[model samples]
Target: MSIEVRSLSKRYGRTWAVRNLSFEVQPGRVTGFLGPNGAGKSTTMRSIVGLDRPTSGEALIGGKRYAQQPAPLREVGTLLDAKSAHRSRRAVDHLRTVAATHGISRARIEEVIGITGLESVATRRAGAFSLGMAQRLGIAVALLGDPHTLILDEPVNGLDPEGVTWIRELLGSLAAEGRTVFLSSHLLAELALVAEQVVIIGRGELIADAPIAALTAETERVRVRTGQLEQLLRLLAADGVQATSLTPDTADIVGLPVDDMARRAAASGIVLLEIAPIHRTLEEAYSELTREAVEYRAGLTEQDAS
Candidate 1:
């Protein structure tokens, strides 16, 4: 199954949460839905699963709107909010209740409980469960119908390191099985590890939609270290290449390949100690991309202010 959001828009009173956003999430891959706080990630996901109606355009699963499906849960499972379940209900009872509505058997519910690692807490009231447990329960509920597509919002919000790894492996396996997996999270590094494609939005507008490799390749830099760093810097400056001095002997050069830098240095009689490309991490890439789009930004410290 594939998800397509075409010219989708959402509004809350006078504010537009998502405006003219469009993207395609292909099957057999994990697509990371990324944005800064209040950038409308949740709003877009909610609209996709029919929890919130779009103000304009459409969000379709397999070329049809979510509500048009006769068996919605069996087609697309969603974990929009971890706490959407009744707090007083036991974990097992909660899944069973949701399954009953779809006529899903109890055996399938148990399988999902085990799949989500919620077997130990199956009989516990949701209110008494920790946030991590609650997240697991929510995932179990989403997987109850054995859906072909999964949409999750901040699925790792309160997980421990082990639980985080577990979720990562599980998502990868699901996508390997040719299921469509779309998720949003604040953990950019973790997203980089799992997501093959990324869809980034800023201020409710589409900013970037591309493969992870392509996005990171756009920010690649060459790091050069030499005793003649100043001479190399001057040479690079004259060539219109952007460079940043990291240390007295090391400089980071952008818009220039490592081999080209080394050749230039050798031509200038500048002996090179080290030269290599520095690949930007997903966190760095995200910070740079959304720097201007962030809704809330922290102020500089007192020392910096001084």
Candidate 2:
């Protein structure tokens, strides 16, 4: 199964949520859906699941629109929100109700309960369950029909460390089984670890669609440090490279390759104490991408006044 979003746009009154977004989530891998809060991540997920209508454009699963799919729950399992179930409904009962709608059997329900490790609280009502437990229950419901594709929105938001690891393994295994797994998360570190590809959005517009490795490579801003700070800065300045001084003896240099820096240092007899190149962390890359798209940029005028 695959998910394809083609110029998907949505609006609420005067507020344009998502704008001409487009991307493809191929089968057999975990694709991270990334954006800052109010970047339309949730709204996009909702539109894909038909929980909300797109003002224009289309979202398709397996080459068919979600609305046109018969037995959508069986083909495309979605967890748009963890708290969609009734507070008073038992964990098992909640799944069973969704199952009943699809005429799924009791045996399948039990299987999903076990898969999600909800056996202990299978009979407990949702109101008393922890956020992690509710997340698991929601996942159980999604997996009840053994869907070929899964879409999760902020799935690891409230999970404990253990729960996070569990979900990681679960998603990895599902992808290994050749299922399409689309995960939307704010946990950039975790996403970097697990996702093979990423789709980035900002203010409902698609920002990037690429493999994780490629995106990281394209955005990599290397950090360099040298001991002969004054001499190094002068040399780099002549080459038009900007360097930030961290200490009298150490400076972080950028805009030049490591090999070039080493040669230059050696020529100047400026024995480099440290010439390390720093790669951008997933968190750093995500922060940089979405900072401009934030609903309101904090400290903007204050910084200007200063």
Candidate 3:
């Protein structure tokens, strides 16, 4: 299954939450949905699941709107919020209820419980569960129907390290099975590891829709340390390589391959103590893309980032 968001726009009276956003999430891959706070990511996901009405355009799953599917759960599984389950209901009961509505069997419910690592807390009341447990239950609910497509928002909100690793593997395996997994997460490093492509939105507009590598390709940099700094600089300057000095003997070269630099410096008699490629992080790329579109720029304080 694939998710298609075509010019999807949603307005709340005088303000537009999402405007003219369009992107396609293909099957057989995990596509990340990323944006800053108040960037309309939640609104867009809700609209895709039919939880919010779009003022203009539409969102589709497998070429049909979410409401058009006769068995929606069987086609699309969503984890919009970890606290979506009934407060007083047992975790197992919550799964059973959702499963029952879709004619899902008891065996499948048990399977999902195991899949989400919720077996130990299955009988616990949801209201009494901790945040991490609730996140597991929410994921269990999403997996109960064995849906072809999953739409999750901040699925790792309160998970421990082990849980985080588990979910990463699960999502990767699901995508390998040709399922469409549209995930939104604030953890950029984790997303970079799991997602092959990303759809970035900013202030209700589409900023980027590309492979992770493509987005960060221009940010490729290489770090170098040479005892003969002047000799290395002259050689690099002769080659027209853009290098920014980081220290008296070290520099950061833009878009230079480590092997190429090492080979060139060796040929030029520039003894390099260290030569390594410093790949740009996804967070760095995202920061550059959304800088102009950010609604609020927070200033650091002694009480803030301490």
Best by TM-score: 3
Ranking by TM-score: 3, 1, 2
Off by over 4 Å in 2: 218-227, 263-269, 299-306
Clashing residue pairs, candidate 1?
Answer: none
* Least well predicted 10-residue stretch by lDDT in candidate 1: 297-306
RMSD of each: 4.3, 4.2, 3.1
User: Per-residue lDDT tens digits of candidate 3, residues 97-195?
Assistant: 999899999999999999988888899899998888998898888888899999999998899999899999999999999999999998999999899
lDDT of 2: 0.85
| Tens-place lDDT digits, model 2, residues 1-306 | 799999999999998889888898999999999876677888888888888899999899998988898998899988977988899999989998999989999999999999999999999999998889989998998898899999998789789998899999999999999999998987889999899999988877887888888766642234555566787788779877777777788666768888888898899888877777777777776777777876646654322100
User: Worst lDDT window (10 residues) for model 3?
Assistant: 297-306
Q: TM-score winner between 1 and 2, please give it.
A: 1
TM-score of each: 0.90, 0.88, 0.93
* Number of backbone-clashing residue pairs for each candidate, in the order shown: 0, 0, 0
